[model samples]
Target: MIPIRAYVAADFAGVAELWRAVFPDDPPYSRAEVAIPAKLAVQPQYLLIATDGERVVGTASGGYDGTRGWLYAVAVAASHRRQGLGARLVQAVEARLAAAGCGKINLQVRAGNADVTGFYESLGYCVEPRVSMGKRLGVNAGGTGTSGP
Candidate 1:
């Protein structure tokens, strides 16, 4: 059986590898880039991972802005997909957010990715039919740069 736990500093490599496997369009995030920064920026209580021993098979990150929490970065390993790993990761993240007193959990999957949106919907996320627009400001949240493989 797979197990869920808090993300450790060393688990970044596995997380990055999983990210690479799941998102083929974009380059994978380097462990060195997302590990320490995510550990420092992401709340320890919100970063949940699923593993078989030291290998991270799945991961999900939750972010809270006091009122609501954004559940993002949910990914499962190539070999581990369709084994409920994705749903488990989401449930774990949701539990953590609920424990932290978050009123609502929000997530946005691409419209073109009907499969992904359906998965989220099956897990109780409703369609937020609104114009979700964005702009690149600089580095950090605004940068046009994406996580490299």
Candidate 2:
């Protein structure tokens, strides 16, 4: 079994590379090195990584907004998929959130990504009757400051 542990500053590059491999279509924020450290400064414990020896194989980022817990950027290297690493990452983050007094956890998967949706479903996540929305507060890697659902 791979070992899952709290993310350290040195793990950023490895994690970012893994994210790019697993989420080629991810938004710019997902690959932002600056934003990542900013998040780590807030709740470092919520960011977790799984490694094989010295190599990072998976990652999961989580947060608590007092009322609820949120999970994002849960990714496993393509070469490491189907080996339960993703589930382990989720479990690790869930434990962290739960210990932080969060009562419920929420996550979002892009619509039409059935494979991803099914993966989460297999891990006990269910689709909610709600629409996912977002607002871009500033320019992203694409250099556009648009906001919408």
Candidate 3:
């Protein structure tokens, strides 16, 4: 059985590879080699990974800033897809956020990604009628720019 657990430093390589495979078009900040470790440094418990023995098959990150919670970088390995691992990862994040006293949780799905949007909907997330905007900060790993929104 696949086990879901908090992400450790050793999981970075596997998680980064998984991110590249799952979100090929994601911005540089989202796919950077330092991203996972950076996030873990802030809130290690919020970064969760699912493993089939030693192999990393899924990952999710959650954050709470008092009033609101956010979910990010949720992915399940292609070989592990359709087995509910994605949902499990999401739930794990949600539970963490809720325990942190977060009232509302939000996430963004790329506009053209219908499958991903539907997956979130199935988990009780609804699209809010609001404009999403972003601004880049420093240099990104790919030398493009930072990613937000």
Residues 1-149, model 1: lDDT tens digits:
79988888788788777777775565223243654475557577778889988888888888888988988778888788888989999998888888888989988776588988888989988987677775433354433455332
Tens-digit lDDT track of model 2 for 1-149: 89999988788889888877887766556564755877878887898999988889999999999999999889888888998999999999999999989998999987788999999899888998987766565455245422222
TM per candidate: 0.83, 0.90, 0.91
lDDT of candidates 1 onward, in order: 0.76, 0.83, 0.85
The CA-based lDDT of model 3 is what?
Answer: 0.85
Stretches of model 3 off by over 4 angstroms after superposition: 141-149
User: How far out, in Å, is residue 4 in model 2?
Assistant: 0.3
For TM-score, candidate 1 versus 3, the one ahead is: 3
Clashes of 3: 0
Report lDDT (Cα) of residue 110, candidate 3: 84
Better structure of 1 and 2 per lDDT? 2
Q: What lDDT does candidate 3 reach at residue 146?
A: 50
Return the candidate ranking by lDDT, descending: 3, 2, 1
